[model samples]
Target: MDEKVVRYKKNSNDIHVLPPSPYTEVPKPNVRREKLSVENEETIQTKKKLEKTKKNFLFDPRRKTFLGRSSLNWARLAAFYTVFYFCLGMFFVILLYVFALILDREVPTYYNKDSTMAVRTTATVVGMGFRPQPMVDDSLIRVSNDLYEQKRIASSLRLYRDVYLIQKTDAKAEPCTELDPASELVPGTACSFSWFDIVSTQDHPCSDNNMYGFKHEEPCVLVKLNKVYGWTPTKGPLPIHIQGLRNIHNNKSIAKPDVYITCDGTNPSDRDAQTEMVYYSLEKPSGSSKYGVIPNYYFPYRNARDHVQPFVLVQFKNLPLHRLISITCRAWSPGIEHETRGMRGMVAFQLYRSQVAEKLIKDDN
Candidate 1:
């Protein structure tokens, strides 16, 4: 029976499962998926924390922080800038006080004749200005095609009218009987400017009838010297013969120096074309007319209250219609120096007659 049982067991186990093979494969852990799940959880937590921080930034004032800065931090920053600017302002004030100490209050510290600095640097000794300059910020005079254009013509006349009225109404001014070239002008004396003599007649032009010579195509330009305090014109080198004649002619009386004015056309080509152009008072002999452009002794312009500007009237007899003419006027005196760059002691301007009226008339047809 033992032998039979042994045989049955052997036969039954004939298809026996062998022990597990050494080459059998085992399942691997999903490490990549586990790592991704851990990263996602951490990202979610970080996002939640950022949102909470943003909410605190917006709503939580008691948190004592705003956009990563506290209110106390901002206040300290502002206070720092305030103190910095205050110190800067104090420094500027100190600089200004030091500058004031170096300068004179009444007189110019660096511009006077005795100034060593002024001697080293080229200074403007004279200034020239003109009136009846209709356009703002401009010195040129433009006349319209039509003489009676009220807007254009009246604008120029209005300035002259105001000046005329002022001169007429001022009772304190002494009657300027003559603009003597040989006379010495007293500094404080207010001489009469014969406004009527130049602008009163139709023959000479510059009258109400002629609209100050604008209607007649003979416009008047009034030139004035800028005021310089404590400065006087020097006697220029006079011609020897003229000086000898004056010395011989006037024995006892001192020979008075004259401020001569000359107006020339800037265009060398067109200079001959406008030969009729002349200075009204200068056309006559010296001391004959009281209305010279620049009179003798019209210097050392005092304050505005006590002094009137020394002015000359320049009249153009005829101008080329609808054309531009560049003209320059110069003041010659020993005390004044001509400057090439600026309008000192000299002024240049263009005279233009508008062809717009003619263009408009042609366009209408």
Candidate 2:
């Protein structure tokens, strides 16, 4: 050994005292593992570089998209919604068309079922009504030539004349007579009501010119019947107390059947007032009838166009004044129902006068 020192070993030979090897085996380079690690580091760097780029939100240039969704994807979503809403709207439109087909045009689907008419299946008949009321709910007529109340009544009557008396349609109407009462109603035609003859007495008796009889101590009241669809009163005899035109003795009068109307006081003193009544628009007797009347041709009102429901003008010559007076009017016909509780087929109004019109009461005494 070349300069070898002898050492006492504790367990084995010391590495510092060991001799170097002459030919050590050289280690092989790890090419596969190094290449794999390099490739992995490159992929990580490339991913980080892509993340740094600003993908435009307005137009994604790399993917040819908008707001991250491709144009084809957006088109598919829009098409789906478009067809969905269109079908929904058309479904409702068809339903509404079907509903419209079941409705009636001229005839009403429902009618008034008031028991007052006595006929339950039919519509309610119109009741009698009046005008010149200061208020609609008020049941009294108070007017005078001297008091300012007459102006209101006059304006109201004028308004009534203009509005309700209007000829709504020009439909051809048939001229009717008592013998041909059925002629008043043709299946397809209207009836002609005499409009000019309503106030055409010997002299404009119950017209607005005489202050409607208020100045002469005679107050005029307008009475009109309510319209009911196709309502015709039955042909019947008159009641015993309802004198109608029976008391009048006129041989020249024609015989015309009619629906009679009468008015009287409910109290005994009211009946004793010596009241004289003149009726305008009373049909001139023209047949086998004995009294003036509302001709039958006016009935079975079909609500025809060009139809103006006629009204009766009553001129009270000696109506009591300065006191509350009660008056009741009734229309008598077999088909008409009279119900006091319902005010059907009848009208009641109170008369109160104390001023200018009352002087007539004094003159008679």
Candidate 3:
């Protein structure tokens, strides 16, 4: 059908034109992603700031800062301590000087008669001491008659040998001279101690050959009065008021004032044991004399220079055999009465016979 229907030529513009896609413009970067990136950057900056702060806190050497300030403070504290100690030392020295000024160089601050206050309040009293005190036990004299114990006694005597020998030298000048019977008791006129007379004879109480009587059954006890600063016993007869009836009857004349020593058995049961003991040289064998323990003029100890301490050597002529006796010896003076303290100026000891001492040793073993 060749009909004249001519196909209409498709126009170039008639071809379907595609519309621009909706996502074509490369969609603007996501807004959320941009915000996330910015946040990450801020977080990193904050971490760095924290690290810097921690470093500064640990040890900052900056002037007027932590470590620097601490060092300066320690130095100031040390300087303060040094100055404080120096001032304290100076104050102590000043106080010592003041104390020294108050004290006397030659004399004691509080002593016998010199200090009236001390005399009334303090009352300086001294006791007696005995040499050859028991070495093993002070309370008991446990010397046996056996050879061993006798040797021990000899050793004790030797300890004081030098002291006894001191008399040989003139180191101690005579302090007293023989008193004239006509004159009143004088300071320098009292009879001096004759060391040779006391110790030269073999039969004497303190003879060197006898080991001061340790070898013999008889024993010599040396007694020394304790020393008190500036104290002197009055040199005169014991006041008549202080004299007992016995003393008055025995010493009717009262011409010689003397210090008497009495040794008595403390135990009533043992009193008989002391009956045989006698005080030697109490009087001249030919005539009656005053009690003799120490002479009156030897007293008033005038310092260490002019006077030597006078000691009495007591000899036990007949100590009880194989028995124990308690003996108490005392120094009697008018002003010096029995005192509760220091055994009332008395010394007491226990005397053990050889057999008793040996038995005691065996029992102890």
Order by TM-score, highest first: 1, 3, 2
* lDDT by residue for model 3 (245-288), tens: 24453334344455566666887877877745434432321111
Give the per-residue lDDT digits (tens) of candidate 1, residues 1-365: 11111223454646443455556665679999999999999999999999998988765677768776788987999899999999999999999999989886545645546655246335436667666776658867876546445247656756655664245455444544335321244434455555554444555555556665577666766666666665555544643333453354432322444565666777885576554654555335222222244555544444324345555677776687767788777776555666668566788877765545677667655
Evaluated at residue 156, the lDDT of candidate 1 is 71
- What lDDT is reached at residue 155 by model 1? 63
Best by lDDT: 2
Give per-residue CA lDDT, model 2, range 1-365, as digits (tens): 33433456688666345444556554679999999999999999998777645455657788888876799999998999999999999999999898789875544455445444537424356588876576778888775545456656767766776676645455566666665664446664565664345665424655667656665657777777787765666554454434435764433423343566677775787777637766665464111122225676766666466667767766666556677778887776555667788788888898876674468646644
Point out the higher-scoring one by TM-score: 1 or 2. Answer: 1
Off by over 4 Å in 3: 1-83, 90-102, 113-126, 134-137, 161-172, 178-197, 235-247, 250-256, 280-291, 305-307, 356-365
Assess the local accuracy of residue 149 in candidate 1 as a C-alpha lDDT between 0 and 100.
Answer: 56
Model 2 residue 227 distance off true place after TM-score fit, in angstroms:
1.1
Question: What overall lDDT, based on C-alpha atoms, would model 1 receive against the true structure?
Answer: 0.59
